[model samples]
Target: MKPLERLGEAKTPDGTVLQLYRHDGAYLIRADGVELMSTRRHLSEDKLAEVACAPLVTKPKARVLIGGLGLGFTLREALRHLGPDAEVVVAELVAEVIQWNANPEYALSAEAMADPRVRIVHEDVSKVLRNNVGGFHAIMLDTDNGPEGMIMKENSRLYATRGIAATMAALKPEGTIAYWSVGDDPGFVRALENAGLEVKAMKVRAHATSGPFHTLYIAS
Candidate 1:
């Protein structure tokens, strides 16, 4: 069997190490020795985009914001769902992650990044949400490991009440937001409901047929 090779790494705002790895044909990213995401199992990520952008498939000139760019699966799935006239703004905090996807040797997201309708922003998603009031027809948040902060300490705020509020404000009146979580986070659901959003928690597999169940929270 081939051994896993460390490709590259970067540091988070809290000084946590984010490492990228490859084994066989799969890519994996770890935060402080914990698995953050992998190309081998990204059905949940694809679902996050499908649920968030499905409503806007026919909406002309629709705009959407994606909070993370894990292997660009969500972005690719979103581009597949939205119309050609729609625009997708991806806000990724870690520059290395973006770089890894752009590097042809890694073969990650270079094609998705080249999409004319897609715009890449190298900034924290929280700040993006704060600045874009009613700016997106849909919002997708797949940062950190669910509502908990695994990659960066500051990412927790993206799931907090304040962060949820910012997402609400950033969305158009009929817009929807989807959150990807590694597990069920009941408390986070309460916070979304408290914000007056009708929440739908969908259990999705990490892989298409089988894998640990991940939660996809759709709120509007």
Candidate 2:
């Protein structure tokens, strides 16, 4: 068996360690010691984009905002679903993760990041949502273990009441927002409803054939 090799490491604002590793051709990103994302299972990430962007497939020049660049699968999948004229703005707080994905030697998301439709913003996703009022046709959140902050303590603000309001305000009248989670959270669903959104929660597999179930929350 090939050994797991640590490729890169960085420190979060709270000083927790973020590390990237490769084993048997698969890449994984972990916060502290918890796995955040992995190239081995990304079906749920793909579904997050598919479900969020489906309504905008035929809408010309649609704009989408994605929180977190994790492995770039969500961005790549969003690009695949949307038309050429559409735009995708990715807000990634960790600059090192962007560098890792853009590193061709890592064979992660370099190609996806280069897609003409993608605009990378090296900033907090909350700030991006706050600044872009009524800007995006779709917003996808696959950040920090979903609705809770596993990597950064500040990330929980994205799912807070004020954050949900800001997120809803940043969307067009009919725009949709999708969230990816490791498990179901009824409280999060209620928060979306309190923000006046109709929420739909779907259980998705981590991989196409078989893997642990994950949750995809779609709100509009």
Candidate 3:
């Protein structure tokens, strides 16, 4: 087996340590000392886009906002599901995460990033959500480990009442927003409802049909 290689490191806006590592030909990202995401287990990430865009796939000129580039699995999946005229805007907090996906040696999301329909923005996703009003047909968020397990302390706001309200305003009428979490968060679900969006919680496996399960909060 190949030993894990440290690809690079970056700091979040709040100065939290974010590191990238490669092991067994797969990539992983860690915040502080906790493993945040890995290339080997991205099925749920793909599902995030698929489930959110299912209703909008036939809509003409559908537009989607993806929070957190991660390895671009969600972005790539969104591109595949939407039509050629569709647009995908990805807001990544850390620029290094975007660079890692563009790295050819990694072959993670190089092609996805180059797609004409896709746009990359180096900014906090919460700001993107707050600034846009009815701009997107769908929004997918996987920026942190739910509302409670925040990699960056500031991210807590995104899952709070005000943040949920901001996201609700950013979406078109009946637009869907899907949030990926490492575990179930009932309080966040209630917050989404209080924000005036219907919500459903789903349990998705970390790897297709195996591994631990993760929660997905789909709201509209």
Candidate 4:
């Protein structure tokens, strides 16, 4: 068994304590002693920023918004697929989690922070989506374990009907919104449908280098 090491800490808007840890070369975030993400060599544990882009972000001027910054895995993987003209904006609620990437001691796994095309915003993703930045090419959300939402009480709203609508409004007509889940979620898909999005879920296996086995909700 791989040992657990404390990496950092994060607190939600409502003041829930989240502890970051590492195991077997993977990173995990926990809240009230519950394991949030047990990272592997793959990005599915932090999907949206990495795996979700496989189908949608092909253009040279793709503007992407990544929700969550877990270990920087998804952000780094995202950079690999984007062109020089691409721009990635990450929305992270916790400032410390962002620091983990910039902090010299933590060894930023994704290094997305250092990238010239990346922008980190310290705020709730839900509020930013309300900003309706307009004309975003893709929006990938890996904010919680899944639609079930345990890390933060308000996180479930992201999967709610209104939230889905807001996300759709924030995107261009041809834009894609990809959601990451720890497991399968059907209700969230229904919300996407209610928002008038053409939705497709791609099931991806949780692992390293295994391709497209995880379910990605591609709503356009």
Candidate 5:
């Protein structure tokens, strides 16, 4: 069957969505109710989750920061791994995205907004990190497309030397920072080292499929 198409969406006290669209069998997230993500790839949710928390050996009793909620995949993974003492702070710049998760009428985020462990802040994550009062045990940024970014151009700052320094300061000693990338970025690895964090950079497929690859940075 063809999926749902051109349904209208919007931002209330929640987050943003002009609309959504159905292409083939997949519904996409659209600015004017158009589609930007898909259900066909929902199979990858568990994979993204695995990568989000792969750095932790035992369950972590600490704090976590998840940059963006792209389809809520990584957040789901992070919550699954953290121990009961853990808390997740999500700083999403697009207020609409936060609203998207709460719009029960359309079900944009599929209940991610309701997770007890998650605290959604409708502000820019960079500012939150720089001004943050406390530190985290694991900081995972599924934000940006790696060195490349998907949303705002200003996001490039998050991968810079100064940005890495801010991130490092937000972490506890031996804390882990995990970043998801659309591709590999040697420059980011260098920046992480400059920040004085031991780093691991590796490539992993988006899902079990060998095709459609992506990269990850695990630093501490």
Candidate 6:
């Protein structure tokens, strides 16, 4: 096997180390020694957009907000599922990640980024949710590992009761929010319910019908 080569690096707003690596034709983004995302395994990430935007297919002028742009799988799938009138807003905390996508060396989501329906925002997603009231038909969050995990400590608020309320307020009537987690989070489920969302939890494989399973929470 070939060794992983470090291609670039950046620092999160909170000073966390974000490194980009390439191995065997695949790209990886890691933070503090933990893999944040990999080009080789993103089935669940694509599923996040598929399940969330499934209902929006018929909804005209559908607008969606994607909290994280890891590898752009979610955004790419979202574009595939929605119509020409639809719009996708991707909020990414790290600017370097966006740059990585645009860099031909990585060849990750550059075309997706150029799609007319897509908009890029280099800011925290929570702020976007708080500021845009009833603006989105669907919201997909794959920012960190899960509700309890933290790539950035501030992201925790997005899963808390208050944050969930903000997210709910940001959605249009019957609009859905999907959260991608490494595993099930019962407490987070309860929090979503307490915030008055109708919730459904699904167990999805890391790859299509194989690999470890991850959890995707869909709430309306």
Question: Can you tell me which runs of candidate 6 are displaced by over 4 Å?
Answer: none
Clashing pairs in 3: none
CA lDDT, candidate 3, residue 135: 95
TM-score of each: 0.97, 0.97, 0.97, 0.87, 0.79, 0.97
Q: In model 6, where is the ten-residue run with the lowest total lDDT?
A: 148-157
Each candidate's number of clashing pairs is 0, 0, 0, 11, 19, 0
lDDT of 5 by residue, 1-220 (tens): 6655654455432233345554664455554333334554433444445655665536556677888765676777777776666688888766555665667765455576677777888776788788873577777776645566444455678888777878878877777778877777777777778777787766666556655667777787
Candidate 4 stretches with Cα past 4 Å from truth are 1-3, 23-26, 45-47, 55-58, 209-214
lDDT of 6 by residue, 1-220 (tens): 7998999999887788989999999888898889988888889998999999987888899999999898889999999999999999999988998999877666799899989999999999999998999999999999889897788776788888888998899999888999999998999999888887889999888888668888999998
What is candidate 1's CA lDDT for residue 136? 96
Candidate with better lDDT, 1 vs 3:
1
Residue-pair clash count for candidate 5: 19
lDDT of each: 0.92, 0.91, 0.89, 0.75, 0.66, 0.90
Residue 78 of model 2, lDDT score: 95
lDDT of 4 by residue, 32-131 (tens): 7886655553456455665556654567777888888766777887888788888888888888888777776665654558789898999888888888
Q: How does model 4 fare in lDDT? A: 0.75
- Candidate 2 Cα RMSD after full superposition onto the native fold (Å): 1.0
Per-residue lDDT of candidate 1, residues 1-220 (tens digit): 9999999989988898999999999999999899988999999999999988887899999999999887899999999999999999999999999999988888699988999999999999999999999999999999888885355787898888899999999999899999999898899999999999999999999998888999999999
lDDT by residue for model 3 over 127-164, one digit each (tens)?
89888889999999998787877878878888888888
Q: What local lDDT score does residue 189 receive in model 5, on the 0 to 100 scale? A: 77
lDDT string for model 2 (1-220, tens) is 7999999998877787899999999999989889888999999999999999887889999999999998999999999899999999999988899999999998798998888999999999999998999999999999888875356787888888998999999999888999998898999999999878999999999999988999999998
- Candidate 2, TM-score vs. the true structure? 0.97
Ranking by lDDT: 1, 2, 6, 3, 4, 5
Reference-based lDDT, residue 29, model 2: 91
Which candidate leads in lDDT? 1
